[model samples]
Target: MDEIVRSNCTDRMRSYLESGCSLHYQNISNLRHLHSCERELEDYINEANAVLKKLQRLVEDAYDATLTANLSAVKVPDYSTADSKMNHEYHFTEEKQEQPADELDRDSSLVTVMILVHNMLKLDYTMQEKIVRSLSLKSSSAEIESYRLMWDLRPYVDGSVMDLAWKSCP
Candidate 1:
């Protein structure tokens, strides 16, 4: 259970007991008052449940926003400027973007979730290599590593899909 729910339940329990405490000491009362107490308790429980759901939704929305912000902070490389013809030796010269201090503070768990989501359902390793081969790029260890990174980023591009067209190509 969520901490918010726990806290709300505790508060409601305290409030309910405080409000009904006098009933315990009162002389034999009609069943109507007992029913009223039960009804009030039910209402309090319902309200607490509603608040818990709202808090959960807010937390989920905040987590999604963080994932979006972190993913967007990564720079996709420009492939048009990259040398199409793979020479004997090649190195990516594209400069990576610098992230803001606050952006860099994103939780590692969120990053792991984003990476797993992107990698899920991706093409098999062999197919990925074939795709890389078609681009006239050699399969050196370093190049393959870079392509793997590109593959990881492929599924996460938001708007302007063409911006990632070349970067995600293999």
Candidate 2:
């Protein structure tokens, strides 16, 4: 659940108890209360979106920094070597002995993985937004409850993947 939802949430259990069992949401104000809640929810989501965007920019900057640093250490292949023609055709360069290729490869791979994780988070948020927008008077109690659980649990976000992403972060 979002921090806003957790902190500023209304007394939902109390409200549910106050409403009589014979009533249907569609027959009443058509979830006007819930509509207001949705707006607040959207505001929280927007805040999160902004933060995610910022995080992505930071990751991109880090990747660019590492790339530039590594690029500076590369040396053009010696044209006089017999095998130079075969390797130079691909424009591959040799890394300075001081900077091991494995370390650079690890940095590049980390950047790629973080990017993939960031995209997954973006997609997850998009799905959550769609789910929030889908709520209506016609929604059954089961459906509404399902939506609540889905929003709270954020099933689209893989916990292990997120943990891995975090673990790899500098």
Measured over all alpha carbons after superposition, the RMSD of each candidate to the real structure, in angstroms, is 25.9, 13.0
Tens digits of lDDT, candidate 1, 1-170: 55765677776566656776445335346455755655664565566456555645655665777667668666553665434533422433222233353445644444444343333322333344454444322447777577667766754444343334334334
Candidate 1 residue spans exceeding 4 A from truth: 1-30, 81-101, 104-170
Q: Give per-residue CA lDDT, model 2, range 30-134, as digits (tens).
A: 568777887897897898789889979978897897788689657555658747576654444344453567778778877877777887778778877787778
Please provide TM-scores, in order, for all candidate models, with all chains considered together.
Answer: 0.34, 0.60
The per-model lDDT (C-alpha) reads: 0.50, 0.74
For model 2, the superposed segments whose C-alpha errors exceed 4 Å read: 1-32, 77-100
Highest TM-score among the candidates is held by which one? 2
Counting clashing residue pairs in each candidate, in order, gives 0, 0
lDDT of 1 at 25: 36
